[model samples]
Target: MKNFNIRSLMIFILFFSLKISAQNSYINQYKTIATELSQEFGIPTVVILSIAYMETGGGTSSACKVLNNHFGMTGRNNVNSSRFKNFTDSKASYRAFCEWVSKRKFYEKLKGSQDHNDWFVAIASSGYSTKPVEWKQKLNLVMKKIGL
Candidate 1:
């Protein structure tokens, strides 16, 4: 039993290490794009990264895999279906998200702010997600986990 417990603990550590590594890779892959979008859209870098991470499940979601939509945006663009919008590339998806956010009423009000909480509140209140409270909570958790 002691040996089994030791093996299980090692396995758990290995699994979590891999998970963290993958997550770090995902963040690094998108961080530059997110930063560029943040500069262009006046949104915080942390906000863009956290939302993308949460929506895409660290770039493993079906929408991201098949549609190249990291933001879970719904509409018809590249694809015929009026579901998730398909982009020519992942960068396009990120650009589209920035554009959408730039058009929001609160954009000018909170532009270039580094406060993640403010961005979360504005986004949630703007009906970005159906569950505003829960969405903000999840964003907070993701930001914390990612050490942002």
Candidate 2:
């Protein structure tokens, strides 16, 4: 009985620590996503990650889980996504978001090009925000706390 109790407590503590670590991992994951976006779109990973964290709470969010949505994107896509089965993961959701973003007319400006500043200007000038005024500021606040 004593051995079993001690082992159970150790397992509980180990599980708790792992959970906290995964929570912290989001900042790094968000940073990675930001870096990838900047390299491809001329937007800094900080800014992009900030936006994603605001939009999806670093992708551990209920919105992403319930809706498979990463960026709060909504529309009628021409991508022939009529089949709605086998959506088993967030990677699929993020891929869909990327495809949708890629298909935008303004995104075409990025084709065969490499200009970071210009890409950011395009993102801002394109009026992509339906809730812009507060999202970025809120993301910045969270980013500061995470040491990003």
lDDT of each: 0.90, 0.57
> On a 0 to 100 scale, what is the lDDT of residue 134 in model 1?
97
Model 1: lDDT equals 0.90
Instruction: Indicate the TM-score of model 1.
Output: 0.93
Q: What stretches of model 1 exceed 4 Å from their correct place?
A: 77-82
What's the true lDDT of residue 67 in model 1? 90
Enumerate clash totals for all models, in the order shown. Answer: 0, 2
The TM-score that candidate 2 achieves is 0.51
Question: Which 10-residue span in candidate 2 carries the lowest summed lDDT?
Answer: 78-87
Which window of 10 residues has the lowest lDDT sum in candidate 1? 75-84
1-148: candidate 1 lDDT, tens digit per residue: 9999999999999999999998898899999999988888889889999999999999999889889999999988665564888899999999998888888999898997888898899988997999999999999999889877
What is the C-alpha lDDT profile of model 2 across 1-148, one tens digit per residue? Answer: 9999999999999998876576467766556554565576544555555555656766676555565556666654334353222234555555554555566676766744544344445554556564444544565576675545
